[model samples]
Target: MLTRWRWFIAVAAACALPSAAQACSCERPSGDLHTQLRTARENAVAIYRARVTAVDPAAFDGKAAVEVLEVFKGPVKPGERLDLPSGGRGACTIAFKAGKEYLMYAQGKDATSVSLCSRTHSVTPGTESELAWLRTGKLPPLPVALQREAVSCEPCDIDLVGGRLIVAPDESPSSWLWPPQAAEAMKEGRPFFTRAHVDSEHSLIVGMSFDGKPFELTQTHEYAAPSACTRRIHLRWCKRLDVTTPAGSPHPVFKCIEPGESSLQCDESKGRESSWRPPESIPADACLWRTSDTALCTLEPRMRLLPAGARASPVLKCRPQDLDRRDRNHFCQVETKPGPTDKAP
Candidate 1:
């Protein structure tokens, strides 16, 4: 009865796919290692530890004969040799070598097909935990303490602040990504060592870490800002007011502040005098980035922050607005309040 239910689930998942083209595109396998094992066990028609006795290499398709050592699922008796569909040129192809052992997950009763995408892999010490769970149905316990090894990411040409790349991709020095393991270390903020690249005028970022993992960055005009709204200008007044500071100094900066009500309007001067208009109500969920203290704010939810040594432009861009109303207002309030510089001291 349990076998029948598992078979039904596999069939249902296949049927639910939109088209045959998406048949192999499984939803990202979720859960921890143990949970994933349970899923694979329930989904597979045959799960066994097998020794590849023979392999027939042919054009387009390959076949292998395996002698079952242990049967986790299916009715195949131990020592029974079965011919399995083994390899192909496609993305799902898995290679099987004669005389080597593997933990195999095969589908179909009469003619089994094994894929690289399945839990099948050569027997190794790394798979001991998974194999133990499959045989005993016990989840592995977490270690009391995890020891982290520092990843030596040698300095690239790019300037870094607080272990973060301080230069933008456009103006960054030659930068490279660490290897998969080393990259994981970098993401976890582990210390890595590498030689720094000489500062160059090149603005494009492209390279790989000493471990040979390629890091690619595409340069664009758009700035990637954080989710926090660092600055906000309130346009609460009904009429546009242009109060120039110090009378005139080429271009005077003006700001309109109103109490309580949140108005998204009041056309202010950006850099030079251009035009003025009444405000409009900004959407409740608007993500806006300020071009400058006095310039109009733009919607840039995915904008990146300005890195060190970035080319100075006339209009300065601020962070995007927060999603939560309270958080947005709280952050905006701090920014709007006068600082020590504004005081008499």
Candidate 2:
């Protein structure tokens, strides 16, 4: 009887084991590349191209520091350092190696993180379309049927389908204020003039610092659709105070005013005064001095945060037994290296 019971237990255990093929299968993701891009953008708080600059091999978690290469879809500027906290050896881990370029789609606005399940992957061939759209503010075409069906509706101030042909949602907002250093100089009464242009209800305010820093300012209103419609509606309202520059030259040149001076003369040729107002929500006395507030002021209007309820499904899940399984089923082994098909056109 004891022998019979042992045979029965062995058979039950064998039946419970998953077939090798079943353990490795993954359901293909839906949507084309553009759709995936839209989904990724909607799900990520930040996205950018960067190179891993340093890694902490001794840390308990896989931690790394990366330098920003391009400002694709984050509140980060080029040259900023991003600290990543979760990587290496988990179902959702991204094994970041030093000296590699990656197109990272990160989550969390404050403490940023990424995973293999994310749209984040190593930069490779055929990926040019996405980056091109980022640099040039161009939108790729969608399927004809989906295009024709999605028209601008009342609830959707901007229709996603029809809007893509006209608006480049990924474009960054034109800077409307000089950098802090330059602004500080102007506040101290520096004598300088700038040529300016206004377009699509937006204007570019340029200036130079006493130390030769260039100030490029842009002020524009952004609009977005409430739902899947790509057409955008007004996201925020911006304002600028009227002020004219000190006299001289044919073009409008903004000049810094003395501490007590309320106004300055403009050049007979042409002069205008422009003062970029902080967002209504920000405190008036705040200044840019080694803090994230500066980036928030710059990238918030421009950085596309994940929308209300979008999800990116993971391709793999590591079970308890799969933890140290360094073989095919191990989650950490699934690396997305750029292949020939990944090249940009």
Candidate 3:
């Protein structure tokens, strides 16, 4: 149930990874370069084919992002969280509230409430018709225990194993998911929040609101039970990504998303640190960024490739293709067509 800003422009280009996070089951301090490879071989991740039934406008915030729904996986309810392998806000948000919705808009430097989704679909970054959503469906399927309760918090605990760190909410935040769970008897299909109370230790569950916090509870030791055996949950982090895990340690996890196509190809760039080639699924004119060193990439928009040896070297050394197409004479123009939507004008 994560969200972020999106570009509406229609150009053919790839985005550079802004930063990264570690979401893989095989996250470790030493890390494994062959982890994704091995995971794919064992079908650790499933690649599903989906088309853009619809898309809402996108907005950018300095922090996280949010988007609307056009087409989606399963019947997305209100407030349900949705994400693609590329790692950005979703097109089909779980609606502000079931049927209620909002538009993505930039609030100065942060991507915050700008407007609500129009009664009639409005113009947006990508063509609503051609927008294709890419994400892992039920990557870690939820346990049946969570589906039974309408208001519940699936445990979001992290544990380290096999030289890697594995972090997942008990059943994946059953009560407070952005797009909400796919289907269940009791489901609070809305974005979850962190509600804190100083005076009263009591916390109330509520729907998503830009102005009001979601589920705020005092940070006191409410469930102070004696430690049952000491279990350590090791984590990894890309200090560069600007993201911190609740757990003391941090890690980097990347998701490759390509719009309107199958098979995400995240090829490591020949000469760059944590950089790679944009797969064939994203758009040419899409705005994307990696908030952490452990982020992801989504390629799309009719293959705006390197025109048969356009230029071998990168202008910005692993930056957005639009900005780093080291073709010199055409460098500035590279990022011209499909730069980030929030890119400073």
Candidate 4:
């Protein structure tokens, strides 16, 4: 009876075991090569092309010494030697071999590691597209169906599709307001405005000039991302506002205004400007219109602006996930007309 009980217990224990152990799984990177590269660059602490100099043989304790050949992103310089983790004895870790060059997307507390789950891979024919981008910063061309076409409009030429305004990098005066590198890219005709997600109800307005009397252009300022805590004393939050400058010009078009404190003061009267009045709505046909108290507007009656609810197009059905996953404030999906072969009988 005891022997029979022991046999039964062993059988029960064996039955309790899982049919198969779970293996490592990784979520595939979304979007095209351009998007993948952008995502990797934003997430990884350091990115570079490097050749492995040495590697640890121990499967559990994998490590590699690599000589940096090129610094694509981050503070690491070329010719710098770095010790990075070789994806160990698991399916998720990268297998780093000595003498092999790799485009590594390194991420960790110190940015000294690689994983098979990342875009990191050996430099080969398979990785030529990535290498080309790293070397010359050229992006892969869009599909023929999704290619952007120029749309002529007043003030600036834009691509208005599905009610979203696609501004050319060169046409944006704000692009010239950026640092020298961005200004140079604008000059080179490389795309600066990759993506935007403007609301269908709203219109994007850029570059307006008065025909008659010369009116003083308002001196506008662009602010940097505000710090969590601006100051240590009152913990007053503040943002750094930089004066807008013209293309290739060092001098600011407007006088630099002193940075102001946040409206967290005890006196409410001081926070509100008494001279400020509610903005009056201007006619749609006028050279300019008041969309809001703080937004710029332009006249585009020829485009025949559609109502918000009627803005949906059958050709362009963008999913919520696609819109949510995008890393931009404004986004516009391309519309594709049905091909001759796609038509039903």
Worst 10 contiguous positions by lDDT, candidate 2? 288-297
Which residue runs does candidate 3 get wrong by more than 4 Å?
Answer: 1-157, 160-282, 289-297, 300-305, 312-345
For each candidate in turn, the TM-score is 0.36, 0.33, 0.17, 0.35
- The candidate, 1 or 2, that scores higher on TM-score is 1
TM-score result, candidate 1: 0.36
> Who is ahead in lDDT, 2 or 3?
2
Number of clashing pairs per prediction, in order = 20, 25, 75, 6
Each prediction's whole-model lDDT (CA): 0.38, 0.36, 0.21, 0.37
Clashing pairs in 4: 87-93, 87-94, 196-330, 196-331, 197-330, 197-331
Q: Please provide, for model 3 over 1-345, each residue's C-alpha lDDT reduced to its tens digit, 9 standing for 90 to 100.
A: 123322211000111111212111211111121222223223322221222233342211112222334322223333433431221222212222223332222112222222211111123432132122122221221111000001111222211121011113243233332112211111333233311111111111122222221211112111111111111222222111111222321222121122122221111222222223331222222212211111122222234444443432212112222222231111011111222222121
Instruction: Indicate the TM-score of model 3.
Output: 0.17
Candidate 1 deviant stretches above 4 angstroms? 1-27, 108-111, 142-345
> Candidate 4: how many backbone clashes?
6
Measured on C-alpha atoms, candidate 4 has an lDDT of 0.37
Location of the lowest summed lDDT over 10 successive residues in candidate 1: 143-152
Provide C-alpha RMSD values for all models, in order: 26.8, 27.0, 23.5, 26.6
* TM-score sort, best first: 1, 4, 2, 3
RMSD value for candidate 3: 23.5
Stretches off by above 4 angstroms in model 4 are 1-22, 142-345
Better of 1 and 3 by TM-score: 1
